[model samples]
Target: MNANVSIQSYGLVAEFDTPGDAMRAASSIRDAGFRKWDVHTPFPVHGLDAAMGIKNSPVGWFTFFGGCTGYTTGMLMIWFMNGFDYKIVVGGKPLFSPFYAFPVCYELTILFAAFATLIGMCFLNRLPRLYHPLLKNRRFAAVTHDKFFVVIETADPKYSPVETRKLLETAGSRHIELIEE
Candidate 1:
């Protein structure tokens, strides 16, 4: 993964052997006005979301949009197909009555909402990324094995590599390194 090396852009990365330290660092970093940051750990840590200031995701908005699209499409399909193309009046009911198409519309809404939730997450997070600059950091392998890491991206406006290192150092971080892009 190291072969395709980019320019050495620097950022602060703090490594901890415990989740507690990682969470503390996350909170402190967030309080310090560092928005471009991420936390990684071997296992899910309780209260980590609060520490990182992560709020409810916007995925619900995606699902809502999908539901709306599905409802409109389903209604249009039923209107055009059943009412205009091939009208059928069963039990002396109105041919284009919306009540008859309610079930199909509801089903399509749920189906599209579910699909949107799944696809929205993947899209927002930019998943299926086979490579990341951080993957080149040898010490990062322990992130999936009982270690915790917090990285502040260099793109952050307040990101001065030296200042970030000092901040992390004061926040009880043990080992810190500069991640190169």
Candidate 2:
């Protein structure tokens, strides 16, 4: 280790004894106009999204468009293969009846929708992250077992160490610590 190396602050993490405490702190932080804060808990907390002011996700729209594209592609491919190209007149049926293409279209729609959902979720959440600063914090390990925590990133423009610490303390955090990057 270099003795002259300077440590950088990743953020401030406030530990709460209960979900309620963490939720309250999160609400206070959100109401304070801090944009880059997050909460971690052992299990899901009801109404946490509302407290955090998180908006509805747009992944559904991706699924919708993917399904539409898949259906259109399936229909067009079938029509081109069976009706226009090969000209297969099976049992005197019509060239391009939707009833015959429905099965393939439905399967393609399902496949594409599922793929879109996975890709959209990964893209939106920025997946494949192999590491995070919080993972290096010993206390944060309790998040997988029992404790709840709220972290406010230093990069947030509204962050002030003194004021943010005071806010967390007022919100009933049991302990607060600066996280090193």
Best by lDDT: 2
Q: Estimate each model's TM-score.
A: 0.89, 0.93
Compose the digit string of candidate 1's lDDT tens values, residues 57-165. 9999999999998888789999999889998877898878789888999899999998998999999999879978889998989897878899998899999868888
Clashes in model 2: which pairs?
Answer: none
The whole-model C-alpha lDDT of candidate 1 against the native structure comes to 0.88
lDDT of 2 by residue, 1-181 (tens): 9989998899999998899888888888889999989999999999999999999999999899889988998999999999899897889899889999999999999889889989988998899688899999999999999899899999999999899899999999878999999
Kindly give the stretch of ten consecutive residues in candidate 1 with the minimal lDDT sum: 4-13
Candidate 1, residue 115: the lDDT equals 91
